[model samples]
Target: MSTKLHSAVEVGHLRKVRRLLTADGANLVNAGDGLAEETPLHLAARLGKADIAEILLDSGADPQLRCRCPFVNKFDMNNGRGDALHIAAAFGHASVIEVLLAACEPQAPDADGYFRLLDLTAMYGHVEALNLLLERCPMDVSVRSQALCFALEHAQIECARALISSGVDVTTPRRLYRPDGKGIRPLQFALSPYSDPCDDHILKTEEEALELVKLLVEAGADVNANATIAHRFGRYDGCDEVSILSCAAHYKLLKAANFLLASGADLNAKDEKGWTALHVAVASGNPENVRLFLDAGASHQVTWNICTVLDNDNYKFTKKWTALDVIGMCDTRILDLRVSLDWKKYTLIGDYTEVIELLVEDGADIEAKHETRYVGNTLLHSACSIANLSAPAGFKRSEFENGIICMNTTIQRLLPTVAAFVKAGANPNCLNRFHETPLHVLLSGVMNAIETVSGSYKYHHAYNWVEEEEKPSIQLLFQCICRTVRVLASAGADLN
Candidate 1:
């Protein structure tokens, strides 16, 4: 009898549904289907039978009646627990949603407190259903805030606009906790390069993301709102008061960055750690964004800015690191400059070159010492150390020998970059706090690579000339290292 009513509701046979309800021995209006345990009204709501849903509701159908279906994926299960209102919201059945709201607790949420009925509609991009729910429902400020965040998280732009226009506070932080244990604002979420990994929604395209950002900004979201969550995670530096522009620079969100900048974001807003957006741009290896910040009055000479640095003993000191220092540390991580067959030929062709040239042209002190306790080295010292530091950990001498030819080619390819620093008047012979010159740093890296490879499995026994067969490859690597040493020496790097 329940199956018959479900079939009638599923097929939108309102007369049959009414007769089933009004008959002398009629099954209850809230009767569950056999397998899914979805009630008759659940079928009506799921199938968009508004009139049948009205019939069921009028005949005492329980709007708050939850189905007993097993949890499937998010879209399959209604907010991980099936309910008639959730079903109607998920299916965009506005009329059914209105009827359900009239009969049920309008403020009721699903099992997850974050997912209210409005959130379900926003998550599925059901704008009409969302509109009806928002207009007729009795949501408080917090639930409305969650609904807006849900819309933005799923890239439901129209729904987001609707929520914002409906007076949901644009500044309401997301209830979802970041690794930093703080809630992120809507602007921060929109500017983040990737959405939360656990979220089922894919990040929107750059244009749509930019549009969302513009919407929020136009709606009075603080453009310089600090992203404490990004700061704590320290993907960039753990500067606790990072702003939206800094976050945009860190993630290389080009369009969103431009929009923020053009929208009059603070150019030199420093985090609590004294790191600015420029510092973040340099650390993120985005020369273009770095240039953008500089063009907007970010200081090229804010070298004395200090961040808390911890030593090996876990003691902390305030240390000064310039953008140039950041650029030096970031240079070798540019994979194109390291892996290209013609990277040597085109050493000045990439973004690293652009950044170096920009810094040089902007009068950055090319000879500034990176004054950290570990190694107070110059730019040249940092660069040379970085060049030969690419050997994989625990690599065997045989593997190094087998790959010696390619290694030599890579060294040859990297020489032009070393030349660029020299041309920029980098003092190669400048000593670090440890009294080690750039030559010493470069040689130490090479010797470390050689030792790391040499201590691995022996390719020959004492009585075998297999050692002799391997000698030339080792010799070739040494020759390449010596040639690099000579190149540095020619640039005034001291051999002694």
Candidate 2:
């Protein structure tokens, strides 16, 4: 057995190596090839040859022999500090894993100081093999495994279920948030049961994911639980920062949204920003959600300004919506009351029909105008003003110049509202304090840009940093000229 046994074992010719060892029926345990620790059992275990392993064990080979100075001793590789169990586990041979676990002494530390059986099994997704190790090995199940994390990341549901059932606290806190803190919990990872939407990784099917979500929710996991713990752990994404209900709202999951709401989730709860659930629904442009929130008593007047909540934020935004200026057609007292009551929390549902009916029932003065202080422009004016037109004077010239907001492109900004007002009988030709009509007020001057504090541009919290030109509203002037031309043409007024 000069070197024939060692070379045959090296090449995995286990039967040949064993034959050479037992040629004279020598005890496999004591059979060594010149090397200090080159035992026949070591060869079989090193190569993960279960057949050879069984043969050597039956032939009186000592299973617990430590191979001292038998192989490469590269200092870089932790001084070659590995054993037969390490080799077998690394190769993922169930039979070899079983043999090593059985032959090793009870609580005997592997050369690495811990036998990570589940870890190895999770890594390879060897379910059957893991089951064997779980049954036979006295390994600690509490050790955090890269394999477990990988299984979750890849969404191997079967493997994850097994690990979870085997006493893995899914919400174990891990340190990822503060520098010296205990860490974040595990349930956070369960927040988004799907893989990266931007990536093409098919982590889980929709049905499978829904089932998982249902199971997690049923198992005392808060369906509306704040998943910010994951965000604290650096999983920075939309899903990580919101509760399940918020996520459903963001993704337009109507059923999920309703379920969360019915389950007593706070609809008015603000997120990291001061945005309530109703705010999100409107910003999402989903009319269904718009109606849902309104019916659920969500405030329509609250607006987000610079990510901060705004009071009395009234605006009905639709492709063909009559702007809030229509509220001017409503009773001033009612408007005052709505402003005072923080009506931003309520949204207009179903054409504001209910709102209109309620106002009618309250005997509201529908024709009341903000002629002096509030500048009551009507619904039609608001609508056309959004198209960049001006409100008609509807008063005398001096009053138009002072009260009509003719300067600073006020007329242009109020164009849609002006048109809405005309459509609602605010009088397109109503004289201002000056003798100029609505069309006359529009033709006053050219426009640059206006300075505004809490209007449409700033309502959504956008920053408009461009410097304003001192010029007046030219668009209004152009509209006025066009209107004059159209009037002269239509009324048979002769051009000089």
In order, what lDDT does every prediction score?
0.65, 0.43
lDDT of 1 at 447: 64
Clashes in model 1: which pairs? Answer: none
lDDT of 1 by residue, 1-496 (tens): 3577887777778778778888822466877766567898888877778888887777887777787422224345433666788777777789888778777776676655445678778877899998988778767888888878777766889999998888889886864455544676888767653444324344677777788899999999999778654321223232245678877776667788888988888888876656677877765557888888878778876753443435357667665667666555413322221211211221222235566677778879888887655678887776666334344221223432323323333344335445657767788888898899878877777765565334332332242423444332445456656766777888877666
Please give the TM-score that candidate 2 achieves against the real structure: 0.40
| Candidate 2: residue 208 Cα off by (Å) | 2.3
lDDT of 2 by residue, 301-323 (tens): 44332211223465433221111
Q: Give residue 149's lDDT in candidate 1 (0 to 100).
A: 78
TM-score of every model versus the real structure: 0.68, 0.40
